[model samples]
Target chain A: MSLNFCFLGAGNLATHLSKSLKEKGFNIIQVYSKTNKSAKTLADVLNSDYTTSPAKITINADVYFVALKDAVFDEVLSKINLENKLVVHCSGSLPVSVLSAYSDKTGVFYPLQTFSKQRDVDFHKIPVFVEANSEEIQNKLIQIAEKISDSVTVLESAKRKYLHIAAVFACNFVNHFYTISAEILKTKDIPFEVLQPLILETALKVQEIEPEKAQTGPAVRFDENIISDHLNEIKDLKNYAELYNSISKSIFEHHQNLK
Target chain B: MSLNFCFLGAGNLATHLSKSLKEKGFNIIQVYSKTNKSAKTLADVLNSDYTTSPAKITINADVYFVALKDAVFDEVLSKINLENKLVVHCSGSLPVSVLSAYSDKTGVFYPLQTFSKQRDVDFHKIPVFVEANSEEIQNKLIQIAEKISDSVTVLESAKRKYLHIAAVFACNFVNHFYTISAEILKTKDIPFEVLQPLILETALKVQEIEPEKAQTGPAVRFDENIISDHLNEIKDLKNYAELYNSISKSIFEHHQNLK
Candidate 1:
């Protein structure tokens, strides 16, 4: 039997997820966004009804995916009447319990990858994390997720939150380091392209070895002179200097613990 | 005319470089290391003479690449004499002046990539930073580098030092974040493979867009609540807690500056 989906937010995640699902032969009954323009844009792509109000959400869908911003999740849940429909929120940090306020068939369907509207994501490679208040809903969500992705797993709320936090550190925080590196290179008229190979290899190394075992650089080797030199170079920038100090000290201490 | 090469150290960088240059038809005439075991191993692979003592370094080579550890670079350089033969140090932090101490024909041939003995680096893609005491040797070093890598540039010592520091942040410090994330996932029985795709994409994204613009996360969005929650979750590990706070604060402040 074909399942129907209603996306509550027509943002990055919503657009990607709905399109992937629709392409996989699922019916997208409706799309809702805080703004009508976004709702219409995404709904037009999926050939689904578009709305800016939660009250106008199609009550006929098998699943209602509330893919809104984290801050507005609670407020938006209050305005919906999911009742018996399986309502899932595609948020990493939020729990499935948030959907229980509006629907008995509450669940979570968080895709464990960063999504950019400008970039097309391969659903087969993305890990869709599913969790729910009941096994029936959990199984249904898992079935739907498995259709789109090769990696589908049921992660509980507790682990999911930590996973989300880790994602922030691994994806978001790591990108900031690249930004800092780019900023540093720009000062000397060096293009960031020079560092691209190094950055790619750094991530690639972990695939073949444990990250702790794969760790390299002056800090891992405890080369205090290079550390001091790097610190001295960035001393003019207060935050970067502090960031360098703290992360280097942490790496030094982590290696010490391993020893 | 094809240049003759002498590698002053049989370490990771030396091994990869010697192999690449030799494959490119540059004759590696001699390989030297403090330990005869490593020297013999690398020399045998390159079909070159091996020695433990720097005094035994062949004077026949056109260029001598000092690829020793930073702590041992000065001591090793003191024991070698090339006179008119060009000398270069494969170090990011050290200036060309270090090589000038032993020979007037001094230069820098720093390959800005992290190498592991077990993995083969594609020399064509590696960025080789070249510098020299004289334009003649500088152009010569660039010529040698260009033979191995498609991307070669002349970068002076001052800018090179900052580039190296930025590299540490981009490659080394960022790897530490992966280590931390791996550690966190291990505690919950989640395999690090779950985060591998995200890690690769995070690095790949910057190849197309600016890192600052590609940045996404709680800190980038200034989601204080999620940031606080993540901090609270990591508070038990003193160093990780501090690292989280320091980097998160730095990212928040950096984004604010751009606004």
Candidate 2:
């Protein structure tokens, strides 16, 4: 049977998955977003119908995915029509059970990847993390997820929460670290391009080895000479200097703790 | 003129650069390290004379790259012959004038990257940041460095110091963030592979946009809901929890300073 799918949000993640699933021969029934333009734009790509309102959305599709921001998930779901359709949310941060009152077979179909409107994502490589309330829905979610990605991970809500937190640490926190580096470089009139190779290398290394094992730094070696020199170097960047010192101190303390 | 490159210390950086330079047709005249194996391994690859004793490294070279540890730069320079053999050190933290007493042709040939034996570097994009006592040595260092790398940045000592400090923030500090993510993933028994795509995308984004404009997370928006949830989620790793909170606070404060 050609399963009919309806998306309740047409954000970056929703747009991407919609396009992918459509290409895989799933019938994308309709798309919903805050604005009609966005919904129509994404629905046009999937060759599906579009709706601007949660209340206007019909219960014709077998699947409905809520792809709103995490903070508004409850408020957004409250307005949705989740009848016999298997309702789900594509959020990594929230659990699937948040849709329990709306539908008997609500679940999660979270794709663990950073989505941006600018970048083109390869859905085949992205690990699809899935979960559901019932066995039938779980199997259906897994089957649908496997159509888009080879790497399908059926995780419990608890584990998915951990993964989301880990993503906050890895992706979001790491971006802040880069912002710090770029800020310093801008002040020095040093072109930020120089940091690119090192950034790529650091990320690649972590993929292959444990971060603790891959660690290489002045702080790790307890190279006080370099740390002191570095401290003096960042003297003009008052806040940045404090950051440098605190991080080195923390890393040094972590190293000591391990020892 | 066949410039005989003599490594004053066959450390990780020294060994990697020596191999790259050797492959590029620059002669590594001698290899010297505190440990015998360190010198021997690099010397074998470089096809050069090797010695553990710095005093025995008597061969004349165009550039004597003192790739010693930061703490032992002075001690190592004292032990080695540095009358006027284009004495330079591969240290980002050390001042160019550290070798001023020993030679007029003093400079730095600091490769701005973290090198490990496991990772084979493609020198094409690696930026070689250099500083020298004289214009002639600076020019010569530039020429020599350009042979291997497409990116050669001729920076004064002040700018070089700034770049070095920025690198610590970029490479070293960014890596600590990676470790934190890995720890979070491990505690949850989630394979780090789940976060790989996210990690790659996060790093790649900065290269295309100004880091300030590219930054996204709960801290920037001051989203207390997610921040509070993350605080509770990270209750087990207290140190890391504090780290996340501390940096987020700093980042938020810094962004305010910008406005």
Candidate 3:
């Protein structure tokens, strides 16, 4: 059966995901956004109707994706009238049941990766996370998502929450660490490009070893000399000094606990 | 003036470096290593004569690169009887004056990047850290390094020591981190390729921002909720748990201090 999709937000994820779904033989009947123009722009591209108001979504679609800010889920659901039509919110942090306010047949279609407006996502490679209200909805959602991605998974809300938290550690936190490293190199008049290979190699390592097992540094080695030298180097930057000290200490302490 | 060349060690570094220098228009007259076979192999490649003994190095290159390990510097220098032959060691941790016993014309050409036999360096981008016995050697070393790389700097041993420490944080430590992240993904049946972009962008952020300014995470944000959840998720992995707690605490503490 050809599934139909109506997306509520014509943002990065919406624009990319809708086009991908449409290309995968799904019928995208409508697009809606807070801004009328953004909705119309996406709707025109998807060959669907564009509307400024969620209340104006007159036609029924098999699946409606509400890709909104985390803070506004409740308000947005309250404004929508999906009636018993299947509606899914694309969020990692929000619970699957959060869409129950708008429609009983609701679920989640969380894509577990970072989305930048400029970077076009390869939906085929991206892991589409699906969580539906019932086994029937799950089957449909899974099939629809699988059409767009080979890496589709039926993750429960609880497990999805765990994955989201893990993503925070693996993605957001990791990013900040890189930023700090670049900052240090910049102050020394070193080009940041010098660290590119090192960075690429780091991420690639996880493919072979567990994160816990793969850990290294003065912290893991208990190399006091290098640790002290690092401490001295970042002394002027108190935050960085503390970061270096604490992470190093944690690495050593973690290893000691193992023994 | 075209500088005459001498290589004090034809070990891995000296072999690669001498080849690179020869390509950069410097004459590599002789190759020396503890093993005559290693020396002969490299010497044959360079068309330079081979010697098993540093003391037997009759032909002098303009710059003699002592690529011997840290433990062997004194032993290697004691045998190499030479006048001012512009002796240098390619070690970031060692002082340029370590060659003081052998010659007044001494400098250090420590490339501030990891070099593994499998990975060939882009010499043009590699940070070549240089220091010399005096200002004259300093200028000469800088020009020589500049011939190979634009990212050349004159750092006395003290600054180079700091740079070495920084390199640990950015490279060695960073690589271990990738191992951890890769493990985290793999345990969930997720491929490491999914995490590559995030890892790359994390490092890229540092090129434009200070590591301190670019730092992000639940730790940096002081989000107690996510931290507690993540801590619980890895509770069975106690060593990793402790590491998580400590690093998170450190990042939180850094933010608290900042505020």
Best by DockQ: 1
Share of true Cα-Cα contacts across chains kept by each model: 0.80, 0.71, 0.30
List lDDT for all candidates, in order.
0.86, 0.81, 0.70
By TM-score, the candidates rank as: 1, 2, 3
The C-alpha stretches of model 3 lying farther than 4 A from their native spots are A1-61, A66-72, A92-107, A118-125, A129-150, A153-166, A186-224, A246-259, B1-62, B66-79, B91-102, B153-166, B186-193, B201-224, B239-259
Output the better candidate (1/2) by TM-score: 1
What TM-score do all the candidates reach, one by one?
0.96, 0.94, 0.72
Candidate 3 reaches a DockQ of: 0.25
Question: What's each prediction's clash count?
Answer: 0, 0, 15
Of models 1 and 3, which has the larger TM-score?
Answer: 1
Candidate 1, residue B96: how far the Cα is off, in Å: 0.9
State which docking tier applies to candidate 2: medium
Model 1 residue B71 lDDT score: 88
Deviation in angstroms for B142 in model 2?
Answer: 1.2
DockQ of all candidate complexes: 0.81, 0.69, 0.25
Report the candidate with higher DockQ, 2 versus 3. Answer: 2
Model 1 has an lDDT value of 0.86
Over A89-193, each residue of candidate 2 has an lDDT whose tens digit, in order, gives 987767777788888888999988776667777899899989999889999999999999989989998888788778877877778878878777888788888
Cα displacement (Å) at residue B231, model 3: 2.5
